[model samples]
Target: MSGNRYGHSSPPMFLVDSGGGHPGEHQYYHQQVLGQGNPPLVPCWTFPPARAKMKKRGTMNNGMTWVLIMILLLVFAALGLGAYQILRLQNQVERLTQEMPAEVESITAQKQVGLPAELIKMKQIRADFIGAHLIGHADQRSSSGTLNWETQLGTAFINGIQYHNGGFQINETGYYFVYSRVEFLIYTCSHKDSHTHRVSVLRRGENRTIMEDHQEGFCKSSNNQKWMTGSHLSSLQRFQESDWLFVNVSHPLFLSKNFQNNFFGLFKI
Candidate 1:
C-alpha cells in the first residue's frame, strides 16, 4: 500500500516482510525502521573463530590428559608387579628357613649311622696315598758319592712332597714308610772278599741313622766282575715337618745309574 512519509508519497516498508527479500533489501528495511524511531533489532549470531579455537584447544587438552592418565596407569602397574615379586621371594625364603633345621637334622642322623664301606675304604686309601718315589739321576755316570735324585717322571713326588739336593723334604708330619735301594757294580774284580755295599737313610744334621742295610755281592772266586745291591726300609716312622731325608751310600761311585734298581720312596701310612 502507498504510505505518506514526511508528507511525501512513498511505499510502506515492513520488517516482517524482510525475510522474503535479498540482503540489500533487508538492510533498507532495517534503516527505514530505524528512521521511523522504532528500536532496531540487534541480531544474535555465534562467532565462529573464537569458539572454534577454544573447542580445538579443549580437545587437545583432553587428549593430553588421557595420555598422562594412561602413562600413570602403566607406571603403577609396573611398580605393583615388582612389589608382588619381592613379596613372593620373601615368602619362599621364610619357608626355606623354617624347614632348614629338619633337613640338617636328617643329614646329621645319616652321618651318625655311618658311611658306606666303599667310602671308608676310599678314605683310608686317600689317607695312605701320600708318598714320593725318586730315582737316581740317569744322565750322570755312576760314582762313589752321595746320589742325586731326579724330579720328573723318572723321579716323582706327590701329595705336596718334593725332592731337592739329593734329599726329600717332608711337607706334612705323619707316619711314613721310607725305603731305598742302591745297586753297586764294578768293572774291576780286584776285591776277593765279599763286596760290601751299604745304603742308609740319613737326615740333615743327625748323628744317628734312621735306617740302614748292608749286603755282600754274589761273586765267584774264579769270576772277575763284581756286583752288589743293598736295600733299606723303615717301618711307619714318625717324621717331623720340613725334615730333609736322603739316601747315603758308603761307595757312591759303584752305585748303578739304573732308576728301577736304585730308587728311594716313602709313603704315608
Candidate 2:
C-alpha cells in the first residue's frame, strides 16, 4: 500500500488499522462521528518547554538576587562588628587606666620630696629679707625686674631663661634647721665720706662688722654657716595674696644705717 497508491489490489480496512489508516479525512474524525459526535480536539501544549526555560531563567535570577542580598547583609554586618570592636577597645583602655592603682602615689610626690619642715622655715626667713620678688626685672636688658615670688611659677631673674625656681616658703614658723651655704663673700668698707661695699652683719640695734674689709675683689668661699648672706642674694619666695612677710636680716642691707630704697620692698611674703 505504501508503494502503489492507484492499484486495485489494496489491503483490507482492518489490515491498515495498525498504521492508523482510516482513508477518510483523519482517523480522529471517525471517532467524532462514532462516539460523541464532536471534534476531539487535542489540547495545545505550549507551556511545558517554555515553562522549563522560564523556570531555569527565574532560578538563575533568584540566585543572583540572593547573592547580592547576602553580600549587602555581610557588608552591613561587618560594619556593625567594626563599630562594636572600636567601642570595646575604648572600654578596655578605660578599664586599664582605672585599674592602675600605683599611679595615685606617683602623682602626689610633694610629701616624699626633700627638705623637712625645719629647713623650710630657715629658708623662708631668708626669703623674707633680700629675696624680694620683682616682676620683669630689667638689668639694662630687654625685660624689667618682674617676679611672682610665689613659686617657680614664673621665670627667674638669674641667668639666661633656663631654670625658674625662685624658692618655696615656710608656712608654719617654729624651731627650724637653717641650711645656709655661704656662696660668695665680698669685703669692703664704706668710704669715710660717701659709700663703699662690704660683707657684714648687723643686729637690730647693735652694728657689728663680721668680716674685715678686704680692698680687693669679692672673695669666694664655701662656709655652711647659719649666719646669713654676706651680700644680698635673690631668694624669690612665693607667698599668698593677703599674707605679709616679716623681713628680718642678719646683715641688714636695707635700713637707716646701710639704707637703700632699692634693696627690698613691695612683696606680700
Clashes of each: 6, 16
Clashes of 2: 16
How much is 203 displaced in model 2, in angstroms?
A: 37
Which window of ten consecutive residues has the lowest lDDT sum in model 1? Answer: 107-116
Tens-place lDDT per residue, model 2, 161-181, is: 112322223333332111111
- For each candidate, the alpha-carbon lDDT, in order, equals 0.60, 0.33
Specify the highest-TM-score model's number.
1
Give Cα distance to truth, residue 189, candidate 1, Å: 2.7
How big is the positional error of residue 22 in model 2, measured in Å on the Cα after superposition?
A: 11
TM-score of each: 0.45, 0.28
Q: What would the per-residue lDDT of candidate 1 be over residues 178-225, giving only the tens digit for each residue?
A: 666667766554334343333344456663566666554345444655
